[model samples]
Target chain A: MDRRDFIRTAAGTGAVLAARPGAFVRDLYAFQETANLSHVEARYYIKLPDREIECQLCPRKCRLGDKERGYCGVRENDGGTYYTLVYGKACARNIDPVEKKPFFHVLPGTAALSIASAGCNVNCKFCQNWEISQVRAEQVTAYDFPPRDVAAAAEANRCPSIAYTYSEPTVFYEYMFDTAVEARRRNIRSLVVTGGLINPEPLEALTKVVDAIKIDLKAFTQAFYKDYVRGDLAPVLEAIKLVARQKIWLEIVYLVIPTLNDEPEEVRKMARWILKEVGPGVPLHFTRFTPMYLIKNLPPTPLSTLRSLRKIALDEGLQYVYTGNIPGDEGENTWCPTCRTLLIRRNGFAVEENAIKGGACPSCRNPVPGIWA
Target chain B: MTESLVVIVRGRGVRSRGGEIAPAVLARIYERGLGLLTGQTGAEEALRTLFAPSDKVGIKINAIAGRELTSPPAVTLPFAGLFSRIGIADRNVVIWDRTNRELRAAGYALNADGPGPRILGTDTAGVGYDAEPFVHRNIASRISAVLTDRVTASVSFAILKDHGLAGVTAGMKNYFGAIHNPNKYHDDHCDPFVAELFDAPPVRTRHRLTVLDALVVQCHRGPAFHAAWAAPAESLIFGTDPVAVDAAGWRLVERLRKEKGLPTLAEEGRPPLYLQTAERLGLGRAAEADIRLLEDEV
Candidate 1:
């Protein structure tokens, strides 16, 4: 749909337009005035000679000249110092169910104060939220929601967690990091939903502040990452390993596109890799893909493809393999991997029943790996 | 087999001893350059050969680097004034960039309307990017309404600079300002994206001419202005063939880089390979042999 139609529909639905469900819509017509951008100094960049700076935040270590922005289009180098133009400028904010972030293992069915800024490090061809993610900071409307305000909003909204989502959180690293720190002070958890294109130093530092991270592993092969995602699979794999090694909770979501990344063999290889590196206890979501952005030529992924991929991961010894986007399906529920007992039953984003007690299956007393209250 | 004409006109006293542009001399350089490139005797006739009297002309400039390296008013205004000589109304011509902030930083006054040769940026309210993306091969970007809806014809009046990614930012790369997401195209030396972006319908159809402002060429460490590496070429390169004009500008930057004892853009592994790709796409001539370069002094 065109932007005007999208805006009209977004205004009408309010919650459906966002990445997460139950997300309240703000003033969709308030496109930011061109001059309305933040000038906060950025971190993780080294100043070079001739008023240039090298951004070390993502795998694309963009070495930029003065007044030049990085690939993310949010961070810029201004006369030897780098600054983020999106700091405290949230383009999208909503109160969503934590299940929408699909963090099945972390405080499921609770509300997460989700936030996003404009810009992303990688250019995924089929990005669902490309309206906010693909554009630069100046292209989108943003609100002046600072870190303390975000924490306060979460607490005021009675949300137990705050989520950095919609766009790639790595591009808006400072805002997410500071907000996570502020949320921690308020005893609210912070969750990160990312493409996992971040550097090791920043990802490690991020794990210290956040409660859990859901990394969208787009595909298995480097070729797919290169051609379709415009990123590297190696770094995302490295990030997964690093995040799993940390004290924080981790989950993986693989968006299976039809005829592009839906080979059973590739999915099998990825399942085996995750089983070997991150272990079977970590949840692996095989999400269905809809035609969006530049990939309009392809059809929405078949339900059978998602179910089969989930079976492959499960067959490869993954304990928590789930299928997403097809709500109310039997794959939406969490089953006890040990005794085949239903632990938590879900319909769409809603939690219908919980049979797990004290993080263990109620029937067999098998420890279910999750953050259960 | 068809030869593209690229005119390089050097005005010796275009810049004053204090390093300011002499508008009269710069005007003379533009007249000579356009006259030679279009094969027309008078400046008015030269412009008439390219633009119709009733056409809305958009002069897209490069103002990302601020005033130091942008297409200065001393250079651009006089050129825009020539459109008036050809019977195109002053209000029908606009000199614009990406944002009003960048335009103002480059010393351009904000003139959405009620002005001569209306000067403004794409960020002006009601003049933002098109609601939908202009999708083409390897390119899907929301183009500025200034180019898509307003202008009937366009002139890529760009500044010449050495880019870190694209190797050379010239007339063809100037259109990057017309799109919302230029940062996404800087991969792999901007090879096919730059060519593909220019080949997009919004640009390939409306684009009529290219005029590279080489008055103060940022031959090295640019797209940004590093004074230590900048050179005063005091010349304007003009051509109707966008690819050929940029290829000439790239050659000029390489010459300046060599004189400064800097490594060539190719040796640095960042040549403007997009020119060749553009040529392959039947945009224009890219190779030096295919371009018939005509040099003149004003």
Candidate 2:
């Protein structure tokens, strides 16, 4: 049978078996499909002396032998040929509010065609979507959703933007980039909901096509990142800086965990860094963290914690500091940086009233930094 | 720890006219190796020593590299057949790997046959992974239900080969088949992770033996098949101590590499650090002084 039929049959049947925490991460060693995964030659990699290859996709720089996969569990080296297995093979697809992506400043309250393929560079302990995100390309059910089909679906669904989200978009860069190009052709915007752990070359190219990018800052201290995220904070910071510098409407979301990353001192440091790097105007959302994945022992971030962090960020001169995942909290509304008028009134992803006229505050006429159309 | 006895049993002309295993020689190989491992007694007592009659044994095979370089059905099925004849119920034995396609490629008949030892992959329709992840140390993964809920004991029936990154892929590294995220653990020449993973309860508690399929050892440019570098070792290595078994397997690969005038895995700077880590964890002895190696041919 064709892979498409196989996937449908596999997923349609009881094949969607409940997973036990395997001996290690959710790489799905048992879902051994053939080279059904894409062999589209990857962009960032160098040929070694023998028939080996080094993947320069992320910080791992996984120097793989003939048939080994990278740390991301997606890319591979086949006789010195590097390839990404999860190019167009999306595992998760949903119509999500752009606010859920927490792109507070970019086209708020619009529905986005959000999609993700399996695999990620970093393994986050608190990943809510580990069932799909932490698995290998073949482990998760893959569909034949190529670039054009993705764009067509977004247009059909009345979505103004396509968001590469849920899983790390960097693992599926080629597919996301192609879809971004296709979406651009159809006059639909492409937004990247990423952890921002990608290398510079890919990120630079992605910014050229995507309209906006929302980065999950994860944590402030490198130690916290190293311990919890299994990824470095420096590269993520570098990515955010690159996105901000390219003037690609960038936003940052820092999920506020109770004790893990919720230290007021660290929050203040992150806030100060943001002010210095992206300036005060770029939207920053301090999201509430829910206990999930491997971190079930920790309690979810309290409502008061999000409020206090928002206060801290606002105090540090971040103009559009907001509290997320908590509905109808005063921090949900965007106040004009100049006149302090509520420019965008939001109540749980629904735009109550837009007071900005032509991308500017109606009262003060100060330009609000966003895609106002 | 008990005396870790590992026997490398080589069969005369083990590979047939078409490059597949000679079933007669293959059967004798298991018989002879099991005989040595069970104190020169026989295969029946060996099976008893390894598993109880009521034990539902999972024979985890490595079939990722395809037929020639993978743990072939010819080698694995005959071993399971030996266990079945020795009074372990056929229904209690399963010869498995990560996926059906690779199992099929390696000449395994993917079966859910109720009457006999079944040959299957984790992707079998009703079985996938556990709904919740089991976190052990640095590992957080969705384990296959076949392992968690189906099998009572496990055996890593892995292929021995020269790994480009991890120095050598043997019995210990073979448990990579058991986890969802083997890819994540390949960093640092797959050092403490492999050792630590074996220490995890799901593996450390349930594991019973290490059977390395060394008949067509990929001594170089592996765990993938490279005909230029592949050798006909025509042997299988068996041991109760997982670390000693893998450490011994590493030596075999190094021997083959030295024969080929190639750099030792250590010279290449990718010695199996898992052996050292495994030693430190007191999993088993890695240095030669601690191991007792026995060799024979069927």
Candidate 3:
């Protein structure tokens, strides 16, 4: 594929064309022949004897020997010092609607300048952006988009917020944290889209900079996590609770897959846990699942499944629950918990009307919890 | 049942003081190893017995740790030259690893065209990893095009070393370089994943031989370079059974570790359990009793 195909501006939408799941080439880019890797020393790693180091950035805490990379395929251990290879290397960058990140409650009807480097801590079987997330940094073409440049581009594009998205942002924690600092200096909000596999210390540091975070809670059971996601469910749950405890706005997306995580009892239990731990005000998005990456045997989740799961979450006392990936559905609209009035009308990513005035419901005058400008 | 044979050919002065392989001694070691492996008097006869004349062969080398501890070209090139002597076209053989940088760091000149045994990496312009993942058991990864598309037959030419996670990385673990995401499989001491990755169609169907470069074995604190723990074994191990070869290499590592007063891999809680998993999958024998090791010095 041509390198130009990776970076293109869409007509009229002002959204750069996002590279799809198969757009990446498995070969290293020609410029990467000399290895265009970053040498910035990583944080949260302990030096061991004999030139080994244990990375404490995420739940994996990967102990690596000299010249070995972590599970993320980006960070490396060179002579007892850990360094991130993807710092300031942008593999995918685009201007997207904040709703595209599925953060309906935070900065809706605005553009988010989204960026991601190559690598993810976990290997989710159903990764939709595997082209960018599942491969090593050299396998995909990357540009030198530094932290300052990222914030400048967001301002130039008139984007209110900059999103560390597409790939797992936590894998590029240093880059994301520094960019968030730069974006905050420019009065631009920063948003994070991640799998929530980060350790508490890093998450606490990250919470101090970013304005909003959307965690993709893959499943509730450890078995589902082991079988499909190749990660531990408990750490993800802990990360979500940790982020929720902070002052930053938090949202959750649970992709409901058939015969995997769509059991009614499991969904009910997850909803109840979220209600009790994260409270009812946090918006929960039950997104539809499509067959992608390593999981092609299963079909796209039926619209009925998303609705039922959303109903389970709503019945468990979540104030703002929405169904995603099925366009024009009524479940996409947010309703006031007090009087059942439509607080925000949304068709796919397009917002028709939002009746929440000054972070309160117009009809019932109940407090709606979100970042309303 | 007959025991599987694993030949250990030792060279008296194969490794020079500068850590470079002496080409003549390395060739002698390979000749002796291949002769014993095929029960033939000549290396060319042994090559002819193992591979067809028209086969496009891939000499997959381990170069992840750079030149310090890698399968050097001085060892593998002469070994590939044996195939050329036996009528396999020089243009049909490619000595490759995961990346050009790693291969270059391992002292290999990058050559993708016009020569004997085209030395290159999977990152070569026309040779990358296959776009579609070859899913097998718990493995869903893109195999290198060198293994999946370009070469009809393969030889795993790997450096023997003690791995931090895999306990001991040998012939089978060498194929980890054949995929795009080896970092994902390093969990659980590389058990079942290493065996399962080898069981994948792209690897299992094409693999023909395991020639381990044991000139300098890093028995402790490795798969990396630690000068204090490295031993100059000056040997080349050859076997047709992939698991049996790695199992023997594991014993060699354990021997060195014991000599240095280090704990056994099992005592350290990382014993390349993948060999047993491979045995269960009918890949090869892992037990020492099932293997017949023949040692001879060149």
All candidates: CA RMSD (Å): 4.0, 3.9, 2.6
For each candidate, report its DockQ versus the true two-chain complex: 0.45, 0.38, 0.57
| Residue B125 alpha-carbon offset, candidate 2, angstroms | 0.6
Candidate 2, B222-270: lDDT as tens digits: 8888887887888889888899899899999999888889899888898
lDDT tens readout by residue for model 1, A85-187: 9999987877778999889988877988888898999889899888788888887777678999889878877789999999999999999999999999999
**Which portions of model 2 show Cα errors greater than 4 Å?**
A1-36, B16-18
Instruction: Please report how far candidate 1 places residue A115 from its true position, in Å.
Output: 0.5
Alpha carbon RMSD to native, model 2: 3.9
TM-score (0 to 1) for chain A, all models?
Answer: 0.93, 0.91, 0.94
Residue A56, model 3: Cα distance from true site in angstroms: 0.6
Global CA lDDT computed for model 2: 0.83
Regions more than 4 Å wrong, model 1: A1-34, B17-19
Model 1's chain A TM-score stands at: 0.93
TM-score of each model, paired residue for residue: 0.95, 0.93, 0.97
| CAPRI quality band, candidate 3 | medium
Q: What is the C-alpha lDDT profile of model 3 across A119-169, one tens digit per residue?
A: 999999999888668888787767778999888888877889999999999
Q: Across all candidates, what is each one's fraction of true contacts kept?
A: 0.38, 0.50, 0.46
The Cα RMSD across the true interface for model 3 is: 2.4
Look at candidate 1 and give me any clashing residue pairs. Answer: none
